[model samples]
Target: MDAVVKKIIMEVKKGDQQAFAELVDLYKDKVYQISYRMLGNVHEAQDVSQEAFLRAYTNLDSYDMNRKFSTWLFRIATNLSIDRIRKKKPDFHLDDPVGGTEDLNYYSQIAADEELPEDKVVQYEMQEWIQNEISELPPKYRSAIILKYLEDLSLKEIGEILNLPVATVKTRIHRGREALRKRLRHS
Candidate 1:
């Protein structure tokens, strides 16, 4: 909604590839973050981020100037992530080995960074656990929760992004939080 972004969007609509690139540079990290949070895989996040930009470019003319561009862009990315989740088939490998009976030698073979303080290690582990639990959520709740908490968007913004009513968005967030609380409590 800033003047600078509006100008860039105008230039992009006028076929300025550099302007589009600038827009990508501005939002790539945010898009990737959303994708990564939703998919929990670096490669898939990267792919989704790229695809979001590509889709935005292709659909540029359809973008409504009256609305916030970020909302529209995020909606596209979230929908694509949801589609990817729905399409994912369980992966199985017939030849894959089962549980490891090997010794602790493999742990030493892998290189690790400098050790963190105890507090930092515990905090990092807790964050990872929470993220894993979030990943287990249904896509609707996951999208609502991530957009609200991780992206720190407003309830109305989240409703717009998910194409739901504000009341529905609030309900989703409440349900999602309750689900997360249950998961955390169980663990």
Candidate 2:
């Protein structure tokens, strides 16, 4: 952890409400994105995000200062998302897939690189299709894939976040990739 975050954590530990709120503000987007991607629902994501923060605050004293607080927060968020998935077994609602799939904006850049406009459109569609496929993966695999590829975390970091071994994380990523490839291939 950086000095500023450490100072904030110390203040939070001392019962500084402002410090806690600052912590939430700093990590809210990342927490929301992880939950949204993991649960594939906006409402659930918001609930999970809020719950994760509450849990973090409640257990802040037990948090090891030696660890990265962001990872710990993500661990809480991902666990809540996984629990929601298990308890709800939410049906694959094609009509209400995960929100925020619209961040993909590569059409112009690719168009300038000799890729025709038609091809760019197809690419965008394929990307959205792939995102949907990812959201459909089993929770473990989905978390691994998202943390690794989307969030750009390393295998060790992903393993820490998911409480899985590195080799297992690798296998999950491989399986997730193959599953996505198979889905696209069939489509």
Candidate 3:
């Protein structure tokens, strides 16, 4: 962490609410994105993201300065998301047939510029299918896969973020990929 961030953390620890709020501002979107990918629910993602920040603020004393703050924050978010997933009955299954979807306007220009309409639709479908399969992974495996692939974190970094052995993280990612492959083959 930079000196300015270290100063912010210190200020928060000293009961400066604004400093804590600033920290939340910096990390909230990332936390929410991780939660959304892990849990596959918008409302729960919002809740988990808010709770993660709260926990981080409350548990500031336990934070080890020797570690990267981003890793620590992500750890908390992922744990919260995992716990949430474990507690809920899953709302959807990968085996279920998907319905048609709305176009993502952001992809519109790029897809139009680069490919024909049919190609864009197929591309979008494939992307959505992959996401669905990933969402169906076991919570532990799902978090590991998302951290490794979607967020593009190194295996070692993922292990650190999740407080798992490097070997364990590797295994989870491998299993998650195999699961996705099997699902795609069936589809």
Best by TM-score: 1
- Tens-place lDDT per residue, model 1, 81-158, is 998888876732223344474444434543768877999989977876777888888889999999999999999999
* Residue-wise C-alpha lDDT for candidate 2, range 1-187, written one tens digit per residue: 3778889999999888878988998899989989888876678889999999999999998899999998899999899989998898646554443456654443322346554599877997776676678787888889998898878888998999999899999999999988778777866
Off by over 4 Å in 3: 90-128, 185-187
Task: Tell me the whole-model lDDT of each prediction, alpha carbons only.
Answer: 0.86, 0.85, 0.83
Which model, 1 or 3, shows the larger TM-score?
1
Worst 10 residues of 1 by lDDT: 90-99
Report the C-alpha lDDT of model 3 over 28-85, residue by residue, as the tens digit.
7788889989977677889998999999988999998777788899999999998888
Q: After superposition, how far is residue 150 of candidate 1 from its true place, in Å?
A: 0.9
RMSD in Å for candidate 3, one decimal? Answer: 6.1
- Listing every candidate in turn, what is its Cα RMSD in Å to the true structure after a full C-alpha superposition? 3.9, 7.5, 6.1
Better of 1 and 2 by lDDT: 1
How does residue 31 of candidate 1 score in lDDT? 90
| After superposition, candidate 1 runs with Cα above 4 Å error | 91-123
Between which residue pairs do clashes occur in model 3? none
TM-score of each: 0.84, 0.79, 0.78
RMSD of 1: 3.9
Descending-lDDT candidate ranking: 1, 2, 3
